[model samples]
Target: MSTTEQAVLFSCAQETQVGILSLPAEQAQVGVVIAVGGPQYRAGSHRQFVLLARRLATAGYAVLRFDYRGMGDSSGSARDFLDASPDIAAAINTLHEHAPEIRSTVIWGLCDAASAALLYLQDTKDTRVTGLCLLNPWVRSETSLARTQVKHYYIQRVMQRTFWTKLLSGQVAWGALKGLARNIRLSKAASPSRGAGDLPFQQRMANAWTDFDGRILLLLSGNDYTAKEFLEYADADTAWSKALKQARLERHDLANADHTFSNRLAQTTVENLTLDWLATTSNAIK
Candidate 1:
């Protein structure tokens, strides 16, 4: 299907946010809102977001890729993903306003943006958002990072011949061994206290995941450390492990893909997975 693209300005508090709306010749009832990750804008790394939006639009879904507060062409003070719920809520409202025919929506996000999507749902409980496409969500913490490094990095390195060669030749530094030891201790440390104090963002995310009745598509990139960390965290945390097994959730892994799915083949695979998942969600909605 042929698609049309245009720039849109929307309100998020006192600031005006910018977005690119991609509409197919025949719009579908379920629209897509692309929640951009921080330290990056709507164009994404190597224009991946732009390509994804266009492909989704070409497949007859109305797509919107936008800059939240303080990112891209938008004007505002900078904030982290934990504080992005308001911005995402605004974007979803804007999408609905632009496409009145849209009855429900799906949030498509990557990295911290994916975390923001769950946060948005947690904060607003917006019923219009019927699905989520999350790619390598951000659940980073000291323990999770240490555990992931020990498992994915240190363990893998120990199995390599080059590591043994360097150790036998006395080329391996003492600091490297100390760092490994520190990581080991951190990896085995107890989970943070959840008594009375404010709950951690990871717990909040898990709560949202468990409470949400909408369909979810989780995509992980095998070559990315961030993706590995997310898997490690999910498997380690009891709440997160249970949430991952929810009936409405689906998961896919791209073995050769990087954090952003920068290459054409990887990008195409992502688009295909998204399209297929969206179709299922749309059918269920009907």
Candidate 2:
């Protein structure tokens, strides 16, 4: 299908946010909003978001790739993913307005932006959002990071001949061993109590996941430590483990892909997976 692109401006927390809207030739009842991760913009790493939006548009899905609050062309002080709920909500509302036929929407996010998508659901139970496409979700806590490093890095290193060669030649720095020890200690330490005004972001994400009635597409990159951390965190946490086992969740692991699905083949796979999952989501609405 042919598609047209348009620049859009929306309001969020009294700030002007910028977005590029990709509209299919035909009217689409299901739209997709790309919630960009930080230290980046709508174009994404290696133009991933740009290509994704176009691919979805060609597949007859309207896509809106936008910069929330302080990122990209949006106006505001820099805010992390933890504070992106309002921005995501505003983008959804704007997309609905622009494409009035849209009855349901999916939020597509990578890295920390995936966490922000869950946080948005937690903060506002917006019925408009019917699906989520999360790529390598961020769950980087001290313990999670330590566990991921120990499991994916140190364990694999010990199994490699190169590691033994380095050790035998005294090429392995003492700091490397000390760092491993520190991570081990941190990994074994008990988590601190929360006496909060607000729940931790990870807990909030788990809450959203447990309560969400919609479908979820979880894409994990095997070569990314962030992806490993998310897996470790989910496996270790009761809330996350239970939530992940839900029937609504669909997961895929791209074994050779990096965090951003940077290569052409991996990017194409991501886009195809999204298109397929979106087809199911749109069908569910009908």
Candidate 3:
């Protein structure tokens, strides 16, 4: 199907925000809302979102990629990723209003934005969110970060012959090793508090994952440490493991891709995977 793309202006908490909406020629009941990560606008790094939106639209799905307040063309005081719920909600409302056929919505997000989407779902329990496509979800906490480093980085380094050669030959800097040790210790000691509100962001993410009943598609980049850390986090936390092990989750790893899947081959791989998943999911639900 042919696609039509248009610029959109919407209000969130009295602040005007900008978005680009891509509408399919053939009407569809499902729409995708792309919630971008911090330090990125809707266009995405390397115009990924623009390309993805067009591709999805051409495949008969409506897509909306928008700027959160304080990012891109949107207006508001600078806010962190955790504070983007209002902006996301506003974008969804705009997409639905413009295309009333969008009865089912899938939120597609990357990195921190993926985490933010989970947070929003936990808070609102919005039924419109029928699915989530999360790529390299950011579940960063000091403890999880530390554990990931120790297991993936440090352990790998310890086994490398080149690392030992440098260390024993005095070619490695002592200060660097000391800093690593200090960080490892600090991260190990920094566990999340047990209290509800005081809980760490990772716990909050896990809570959202548990509460959300929507279908989920998780894409992991093999070269991205952040994605690896999420896997490690699942192993470290019993709650995370319990929820994930028994959930209706679909996961895929693009071994050749980096964090953003910048290369042409990797980028195409992501797009195809996403389109295929959406097609299959839509069929299943219908």
Candidate 4:
């Protein structure tokens, strides 16, 4: 069957409107909503997301690729990570309303967006989602630490510090050293911790997956930095890996693919594998 492609806008929430590219097939059994990665608004329009959406649509699945609020053509402010969950929920709701006949709804997310979708599923308990496709999800505990490293490496020298006792004691040199020490301590404190907020983003994501009744597909790349990060944070005995194995989720690791599947052959391989997986899983569910 031929695929019909269209550009449309749908409200993600009460006042938020998202830009979407829809691929409609003649006889689609499921609908997929894609969530692209990047915490910043500018990165949402990366070529990988668009290419994957079109490829899946052409392969007979109805696909909707949209920008999260505040990114691309979507309505919202920039730097709104906390709001990503609601944005995804809104997109899923919109898909269901737009394609009521499609019984299965699959959510495809990459990097941080994948984590956001998991959080949404956990909070809403929306059972309409029949499958989840994660592309190099970013679920690492050291995300905060990495951010701190960047700041320290690039901008630490420019910051100024105040010495509290220097004004009182008139010991200028000692006070200066004390001020420097205090600044160091403050920076250390501000650095991301390994607590709940510091927990690997993926482990937090596992909470939702543990309860999901649908199928899951994890696509990893041996050369991808995110995959390397996963190895660093994931324990050998962790529940996340165990659950994935037990669930029999299709796991594919492209030896040469980068995080974004920048290589043309790698990207094509991913496309083909994903389409095949969807076809097989869809048939089994039917």
Candidate 5:
């Protein structure tokens, strides 16, 4: 474990200040901007990210981990998840401003946050983003949802959607399973929204990644349900294979880890692997 600095507040978009843990070194050569998962924001919940940031900082890299807008101590609505791209972009801009000497900037994200980063980079034209470190990134398409857990969790999601849809439909009646079933059916039958969901971002990201002149390290956990889903999709999609082949992206699989690396040993392994990759890539570039 390395020395870690205390948390600080940084202003992002429109007077919204996010809670950030800044780990700085006297001769930092690079800076990493990290975003945690959606449901996680408490300092305790992000101990792994904090530990990694401190360790990386000790290794001559400045690291910034901030709570996304509307989560944790940040000033914003929870709905910010719907448009978190700006949050990431704002964090990147703030990092560069705070540390102008940082020659390289890498964005690291887990799960949905990783998906947000992909979309953010695609939409923002002048960002200084140099590379990406995605951990079990969410890249599921409509078809991919079919393979998802259709039990309690899915049923709950269906019920929530039903409640909202019925409220909007002016139907005052509500039956738990019945309403949920109706909503699921409606959702399945509804036409897909154009220019929305993960497709546009996936297409743009796949294209950008293929032509990107920078390096990308994709880390996947063998036991991660999301990773399994992605693998299924990848195995079925030739475009994904072609894109990865053309991009020359690097992939690493942690055979014994879960999506969050809940196990201490697994988390440590992930941290070490990430640090090693950073050091190797940094030296190679130099």
Candidate 6:
């Protein structure tokens, strides 16, 4: 299928949001709205979003990659993904308006953006979102971060023979030991029960995830700490796990990929996986 890209500016709660809508010659009933995370804009880290939008559009699905309030060319004070529901909603609305052929939308996001997408869909109870494609979702907390560092970073390094070799050779960084000690303390004091569902932002996502009766795809980057942290939390608690059980859910891991899937091969893998998932899990597609 052929696709064309259009720049879209839409209003959301008095702020002007900017987005690029990639429309196929014949659009699928289900479109994808990508949420940008952190300081990254609509182009994504290494233009991942731009390339992804074009690829998905080429596969016959409409895709919208946008910048929230303050980021990119959008106007307003700078805001993080935690407070981005309005932006997400606005993007979805744009898709529906510009592409009337689109009957449902999927929120595709990575890192904190994934967290924001879940929070938005749950808090707004927006009926238009029929699916979620979450990649390495951000489920960080002081405790979780501490515990992850202690377990995955510190413990693993300590057990390594090279660590002992460096220690004996006086090449070890003592400052790291101090940091490890602090993280260990936090880990011990931190409880797995004190995860996302307990905080307002994650709470919204948790509520929505628990009650969301839609299709979901959980993508994991095996080499990322953030991805490991999410798994640790899920293994310790039932909040996200139980909800996932009730939904039409699938999970995949790119064992050699980084957080942003920066490598071209990794990016292409994600592109293909997403298109395949959208095709099979589409609620609006017969």
RMSD of each: 1.2, 1.5, 1.7, 8.6, 7.8, 2.3
Best by TM-score: 1
Worst 10 residues of 3 by lDDT: 190-199
TM-score of every model versus the real structure:
0.97, 0.96, 0.94, 0.75, 0.76, 0.92
lDDT of each: 0.91, 0.91, 0.87, 0.67, 0.68, 0.86
Positional deviation of residue 138's Cα in model 4 after best superposition, in angstroms: 0.8
Question: How big is the positional error of residue 87 in model 6, measured in Å on the Cα after superposition?
Answer: 0.6
- Candidate 3 — which residues are off by over 4 angstroms? 168-170
Candidate 1: Cα lDDT at 194 = 66
Deviation from native of the Cα of residue 93 in model 5, angstroms? 1.7
Candidate 4 versus the native: TM-score? Answer: 0.75
Q: Which lDDT tens digits does candidate 4 get at residues 1-286? A: 5667666677655556554545566667788888767754322334776777777877778777777777777776754443577777777777667667777888887777767778778778887888888877776544433433334432453343333355446745565555545544544443233365544445557768787778888888877667655543443325566666655578888888888788789878878887887887788778
Ten-residue segment with the worst summed lDDT in candidate 6? Answer: 190-199
Q: How close is candidate 2 to the true structure, as a TM-score?
A: 0.96
Candidate 1 per-residue lDDT, tens place, 66-106, comes to 99889989999878899999888888888888888998899
| Model 6 TM-score, all chains together | 0.92
Better of 2 and 4 by lDDT: 2
CA lDDT for candidate 1: 0.91
When 1 and 2 are scored with TM-score, the better candidate is 1
Error of 1 at 234 (Å): 1.1
Q: Write the per-residue lDDT of candidate 6 for residues 161-183, one digit (tens) a residue.
A: 99989977889977778899999
Q: Give the per-residue lDDT of model 3 (tens digit) for 197-227.
A: 6667677778888888878888999999989
